[model samples]
Target chain A: MDKTVNQKAWFLVLPVFLVVAFSAVLPLMTVVNYSMQDTFGNNQFFWNGVGWFKELLDPSTDLGGRFLASLGRNLFFSLVILAIEVPLGIVVALSMPRQGWTVAACLVILALPLLIPWNVVGTIWQIFGRPDIGLLGYVLNHIGIDYNYVSNEIDAWVTVIVMDVWHWTSLVALLCYAGLKSIPEAYYQAAQIDGASRWAVFKAIQLPKMNRVLLIAVLLRFMDSFMIYTEPFVVTGGGPGNSTTFVSIELVKIALGQFDLGKAAALSLVYNLIILIVCWIFYTVMTNASAERKPQEGAA
Target chain B: MARIDLVDLAHSYGGNDAPQDSFALKPVTMTWRQGGAYALLGPSGCGKTTLLNVISGIITPSRGKILFDGEDITPLSTQKRNIAQVFQFPVIYDTMTVGQNLAFPLKNRGVPKAEIDKRVAEIGRLLDLEPYLNRKATRLTADAKQKISLGRGLVRSDVAAVLFDEPLTVIDPELKWQLRSKLKALHRELDLTMIYVTHDQTEALTFADTVVVMHDGRVVQSGTPAELFDKPAHTFVGYFIGSPGMNIIPAEVRGREAKVGDHVIALNRSYDKLPDGAKIEIGVRPEFVEVVAPAPGLLSAKIERVDDLGRIRFARARLGDAKLAARAPAGFTSPDGTAGLKFDPSHVHVYADSLLVEGAA
Candidate 1:
């Protein structure tokens, strides 16, 4: 048997390649150029020969040490957000009604928070967590607890985490609800015939079936939490010390706050590399886990 | 094995209604014997599925008593009813192996591991799925997945009944015949009370020993296939069960005969009382209608169209304002112009106000 191959299909993708090269590749090349060179004012540049990268790798320097610390903090925050949000979102989704006008009402309400601007979300939470006047901080302080997000690093971290949950938990819930709704009613009927308890039904049927969507939710939450900046920066401003200074905040302070352009460029490159590596690990683990299972056709 | 009895069952989606919007399924009383294969045959939106859901306890009836082996189970949950149902589409878990999918219910019930394995093997063998046991269920073809669904239902022997809700609708035409026969064989082997629901007459007639014909939220007729074919108690039953359906031509009842247009056909049986001004209809199956040359016969017809279905020939002819279908053998020939149609008096049925008149031929 002979096979026919089409080579002209590459023409259709040429425009997309050009667009990506102009938008993404060009800017990335500029960043790489800046990272490798030391610049004084008036555009005079000299090759630093990996000098900034070396210093950033050394733990004694402020840049290297602070970068490592913030990286650890970002990882911790992403893990905590995933741990709390995924299951809570699933629970909320499962409790939603299957049909009716109430389902539409619930969906609209859940989507409202996601539609708000990210910067506005940061500002709103900033005022909402104030110790003296804010509703949450006032209640906690009234109950004989000291809650000051500005001065305390732990409080800042907690406030940022809570704000994240409030802002992004609805996304996970909506995805889960869509997954649950896509499930055929026959599964429920089969479960009932099997005399499965509510928990058993959820474990065997609901959870396993929502695996694909749950992977999506986890990856989205992980990436978003890792790149988190607006809300935490607005609330903490990198904190009273180095405690709540995540990678993004530290990168911003180096690049713009201190105007150390060459080092900032090197730090930004390292930051991007970290995110890329972590995201690649997450994608690899998830895909490997999925591939280990039997290859079921038509799952998508 | 247990008999299921539905007493005074009625279901309404909302509260008490007006005359037109009262109930989806009117109050019904029926009993299904153990080890019997039954079918609920009806058109779309005829409430056959609603009645089946009520029996399965998926939907609680507004007013009814459901008895399984003399035990009240009306208020019981579906899980408590112990009834297995195969739905319109295949619903097997995509992530599990064929063996694991079949073994799920048994595992949920905490059956011994060995017993569960044995039962899964048995069901897999019955379904011709033994070779694919290790394969994920969703990887199989549509028909194969449906067989897995069927096997999942048939895996458990302790269930009270197995219900099929148009389970073969998604199956290919050639596979439907094979699966239907397999189900019949399974019913005979297991002696489980199986209730199959479908709007297809061929499936109902071939699979069920007792076919329950439903129309407009009511059970029009419930009897053996032969009984339903030979003697349909209602006009709807006569119209629904046969291929080409039954020819229901409006007629007027005179002493011992029915008048169709200007021709009067003699009846073989007598009715005690034919109600005054009651609209009557004469029903005759296509098989019983004989076509002959236009002679001085009981009725005259013009041959309109002839349909040859390989083995049988169907001649649709016009008799005055009414059209009648006549079935003949494959080699039977008829002229295209005018043809005379005659009906055997004994095969004719007289219906008044949709109900079959007693002792009417």
Candidate 2:
């Protein structure tokens, strides 16, 4: 018997390789180069040789101080956003009807916010939350509440959190809705026959079925919240006294605001490393949970 | 086990002019005996599932009273009705182990831990799922998952009834026969009331003691399989129950005989009370029809097609404007040209205006 084979299929992957090399690898190499050396205005450089790393890791240094603070802030923000958005999204998804033009209308409305650019979201919120002319602030002041987001640290933090929720909660809701829709009607009938309460049905059938999509929602929200910059930058300018200064905002301050090339490079690398490690941990944990419950690979 | 009674039960999806357009289930009044296995058999869109759902309290009848053991249960929810249902596809929790899935209802009802374990083990054994008890349900094959679904429904022994809605449709042919027999044995052992709904005539006839033949949203006849075959209450039942169904030949009733195109067939009993000018049809099971070599018979037909189903050969022929089918033993052959057909007067059924005449046979 003769075997038939096609080796020319390698050509199909060439364009993908070139695109990744140009887009991802090139920028990554530049960041790696910047992290190792100190440069002055005259295009002359000095071998820092991990000097920036030592400074950033040292407990006594200002860079170290900002690094720890921003890391804590970012972690807190991501956790809060996940805690709020996931449940809220699930509630919204469940309340939506299962059929007809209404479902289409709800989906279109939910997706509208996701289509807006991040910078535009930030700009819109910045203007919308103004103390003097903005409708929200005007209504609040008329209702006799001293609502000043720009000057109050707590208010700024609250505003940023709320903005993030409004901008991204739909993503989690949409994912959950898709998961819910994919569930077979048979499961619901079974639950009905089992005399399962509404809560039991949701806990046993809906939640377990939505696990894969929920993991995606969590990881996406975590990574995006960790690297969030444009919205907070446009709204608070990392202000109300560094209260809303997340890691990304701090990295920009060190790189462009202070012109500390060596230190900024080290800080940026550290930030990237933190994200990669956390994301890896999240992925590993979720994948293991799902795989452990996956039915045996093959059975008759 | 308790007997269920449905009184004046009718359901309509939306109000419309014609009955078919409005009501999925026409008004039905019937009583199901305790611990009896019953089947609602019909083709698709014949309202079998709708009737089953109404009995299970999943769909409330628009006009009816449902009584379980002489108590009105029309207003009760499905959970309150204490009925277990098995669906067309398996409905097991994929994340839970097979043992856990079986134990879920008992646990929810606060059954003692020891009792739960014993019940789960028994059900697992019953379903041949003991080997996969510790394995997660999602990893099992489709058939295995369906077995788990069946186990879940059967685990709670104190439930009022067990309803199956085409539950074996997803199983492969070989496995379907296996599981169906298993279900029959389980019903005998448990002595539980079981109502199975299926469009397949074989499944209905083989599994249930009493087969409820339904058509166009109403129950036409409910009786033993033999009764449905030998003495159908309605013309629809005569045409719907058998293989190739029963041959319905259009005829004009004259006194005590039925007149086909050019010949008259004698009826064993007379229906002189039938209204004048009433259009009628003669019904005969394919098994009772005899094909002869131009003997003194009622009508002559040309053979159209022949179907050989191993043990039996069914010959389809046309008589005048009506089609007739006859079943004979495997080796029976049809002649080359026109064939004479004769029906036993004792087996002949006379229908007037789509309804069986009172005294005609």
Q: Residues B1-361, candidate 2, lDDT per residue (tens digit)?
A: 7899989888876643456546899888999998999999998998998888888877877788989999999999877787888888778886689999998887777789999899999999988999999987888877888788878878886788889999887778998888899889989988889999999889999999999988889888999999999878888889888887888888877767888877988888887787777778889999888666556654778778877787777778888778888765455566685677878878888887767776734
Provide the global lDDT of candidate 2 against the true structure: 0.85
Task: Identify the CAPRI category of the predicted complex in candidate 1.
Answer: acceptable
lDDT of 2 at A100: 97
lDDT value for model 1:
0.85
Instruction: Itemize residue pairs with steric clashes in candidate 2.
Output: A295-B139, A296-B139, B348-B361
For model 1, the superposed segments whose C-alpha errors exceed 4 Å read A1-22, A277-300, B16-21, B328-336
Q: Candidate 1, what DockQ?
A: 0.48
The best candidate in terms of DockQ: 2
Model 1 backbone overlap count:
1
Task: List interface RMSDs for the candidates, in order.
Answer: 2.9, 2.6
Residue lDDT tens for model 2, A219-275: 999899999999999999998889889999999998899877777889999888988
After TM-score superposition, the amount by which residue B287's alpha carbon in candidate 2 deviates from its true location, in angstroms, is 1.7
lDDT of 2 at A239: 88
Here the TM-score of candidate 2's chain B is 0.93
